[model samples]
Target: MFMTTDVTDLAAVRAEHVRHIATTLRDVRGPLIPILHAVQEDLGHVDQADVPVIADVLNLSVAEVHGVVTFYRDFRRAPGGRTTVRVCQAEACQAVGAEALGEHAKRRTGVGFGATTSDGAVTLDEVFCLGNCALGPAVQVGDRLHGRVTPARLDALLGEAR
Candidate 1:
């Protein structure tokens, strides 16, 4: 599900997002990382429909543009589901069994990074960090962050949302 969206032509929105991206990169020299972030934040996702527009706005080849978007872990070409569940996958979290946590989430949510539940109750993303390194295996559900997440702990955490 999208947030804070209003009626507006897709072309107009994409162009506006492009302008924002251009403006954001006006001071920076190379790389469109900043622009990409701005665009994603503004547009929710960089829909494939805007690829050409983004290329023109950033003066990048289509391949180059697509490559950058896909290469980065942060970019999303589609809107996130209702609940954005971000489980840390960084070294600190992984050291504390984040790998198992990820599997548990996949099995439980029936979706992985960039995926949403059928009813859109949740969206799961394997983020690299949540800045809670001391609380390894941390999982962020929407705005709330939790530490020491296990399958059972995650189950209880998710139950609260229902």
Candidate 2:
């Protein structure tokens, strides 16, 4: 069976999680990044409502916490898909047809970079490098990295993700 939480109840629960994370890590040196990372790890993304709670714990302004969250691409402002598909776009990968593969992925997924699929199956992202230059045209599906991927291969991968 499926259960639905009221929006306000969800918000309250998220706030409590954020507050707990912030308070737990506030004493560490340069706590903001760790706190943010922990929040994202535990709750998917850093909700806008989390900023003030974190700021208050760390004795900073909401603007300060918000700045850290917004400045980093690694930090997602909203929930992403269950699977993250990252295509390397560095010079090496680009030299080996990454651009075309990326285009194909966008067309197939019907979502642009930084956006998740409507069904929340996959999120497509472009990364500068995955450190697999020797095998250019690398694509990372979640934590696993693949190299020398063709469009057909990518389709297979997406099919698995779906």
Candidate 3:
């Protein structure tokens, strides 16, 4: 049900949205995080073009805004797929074949970590932990978490995602 914006109009629209969000939330204490979150919530990702607009509204330098965006793993620099798949790469998960699972996912999805599939159906990502150590090799698809995932299980999950 997600629709993409035309490339030609994307920048202008993105700037407008970022400016509005920053302006609305400017008065909030420690407003940067909330403004960034709101921008991402509405625009799917924080475009580079948005950095200046946010900085201008918050009375911050472009570097300050850009630094925050890049520092947080939660913020996407570009649009992601409709579904996000996060595989835990923490010690617990890696101890139990999570690395192999992650590799399989990359090969199957034809995209590396933080990259969306060509068709925009899925985005593959790696996470440090999912707090399911008892159940290592955890994979989060969209909002649902699955533990003890195997290659076949991951394939099935990706199929469902697409």
Considering every candidate listed, which one attains the maximal TM-score? 2
- Candidate 2 C-alpha lDDT tens digits along 22-106: 8999889999999999999999888898999999999999998889999999899899999999999889999999999999999
Candidate closer to the true structure by lDDT (higher is better), 2 or 3: 2
lDDT of 3 by residue, 41-134 (tens): 8988998889999999988999999999999999998889999999999999999999999999999999999899999999999999999998
lDDT tens per residue, model 1, 97-120: 999998898888788776888876
Count clashing residue pairs in model 2. Answer: 0
TM-score of each: 0.73, 0.93, 0.88
Distance (Å) between predicted and true CA of 56, model 2? Answer: 0.9
Give stretches of model 2 more than 4 Å off: 1-5
- What TM value does model 2 have? 0.93
In candidate 1, how many clashes are counted? 0
RMSD of each: 4.9, 2.2, 3.9
Evaluate all candidate structures by whole-model CA lDDT and list the values in order: 0.80, 0.93, 0.93
